[model samples]
Target: MSLANVFSIAGSGMSAQSIRLNATSSNIANAETVSSSIDETYRARYPVFAHAMNDAQEEGSLFEDQPKAVGAGVQVMGVVESQEALQARYDPNHPMANEEGYVYYPNVNVVEQMADMISASRSFQTNVDVLNTAKSMMQKVLTLGQ
Candidate 1:
């Protein structure tokens, strides 16, 4: 594979990580939200990713065997909500309390959300590092031509 392809791969990784970080941030932001009903509570969201394999081969092109066309990257499939049950809090005096004197809270676990945030942040940093490394390697390659 050409050194140029490294940039493309790393760039895709960075983009995917950015999306993950955004979703994690959104989940954390809504973690403490309360609702009078389960339908109103915010559920935790997570980004799904898939491997973006080179599709040139599937396209059945004559140049399929070339490594230039084999570059793989990461793809964000979609965001999915957690299916965990909502937390039921007994708060007779709470404004959002239901007729049964119970308020519904999001099932978002604060600790887990924080951990996911950290992991996503770290993954983003790692992708940035990958891009930086690819850039340095590309620069070195250019120097060889000079």
Candidate 2:
């Protein structure tokens, strides 16, 4: 890919990582939230990404030659809620306790969320490095005649 395309690809990666960070942050924020009912509890949400591949397809199949199938970058497909069962706490005195003297907490795993945050942060940093390196490369290219 061209140095110019590097900028576009890195930018897209940065954007996708930003979305992932946001999702992780949201999940962390609601990790401890308690609810009286399952419907009211906050479910951990995650962002989905899809390869930004070109629409052109090979004859009779979605597959294409490597060069033609070069990914543009990535895009956030959507956010999906975790389907894991919620935690039920037997806190009879809690204000949000249900009729059965149980309060429902989100299924968010704090440790997992922390790991996700770290991964997203590193991915973002990597993309930033990519852009910076691309910029330096482009600058050097301009100096080839000097």
Candidate 3:
């Protein structure tokens, strides 16, 4: 793979991490939200990611063999809501309680969402480091000709 591909891969990783962070934050924000109806309760959201690959021929191979598939970057397939059952609390006096004196809470777990946030933040930072390293390498290569 060419050095230029490093930038593309790192950028895609950053983008994917950003989406993950967003979803985690959203889940955390709605963790305590209550709904009178089960259908209206917010569900924890997670982002789906897939590896993007490209078929590239070797730059200077003499045999002209078949192209090899290489990892280009990560792509966000989509965000999906968790299917886990929502939290049903029996709070007869609560204003949002339904006729059955039950209020539906989001399925989001605060601790889990916090962990996901930390992971996504670290992944994003790692991608930033990769880009910086690639940039430094490219600069050094240019200086070699000076």
Candidate with best TM-score: 3
Off by over 4 Å in 2: 55-67
**Over the stretch 1-146, how does candidate 1's per-residue lDDT look in tens digits?**
56666778888888888888888788878877888888888988888998887744334556655543464789989999999998999998999888999888887888987888788788878878888888888778889977
Give each prediction's root-mean-square deviation over alpha carbons. Answer: 3.7, 3.8, 2.1
How close to the true structure is residue 66 of candidate 3, measured as C-alpha lDDT? 65
Q: Report the lDDT tens digits of candidate 3 across residue range 105-137.
A: 999989989999999999999999999999999
TM-score for every candidate vs. truth? 0.85, 0.90, 0.94
Better of 1 and 3 by lDDT: 3
Question: lDDT for every model?
Answer: 0.82, 0.90, 0.94
Instruction: Indicate the residue-level lDDT of 113 in model 2.
Output: 97
Model 2, 63-118: lDDT tens digits are 74443566789998999999999999999999999899999999999999999999
Model 1 misses residue 7 by how many Å? 1.4
Q: Clash number for every model? A: 0, 0, 0
Question: Candidate 1 deviates by what RMSD?
Answer: 3.7
Alpha-carbon error at 27 in model 2, in Å?
0.8
Residue 63 deviation, candidate 1, in Å? 17
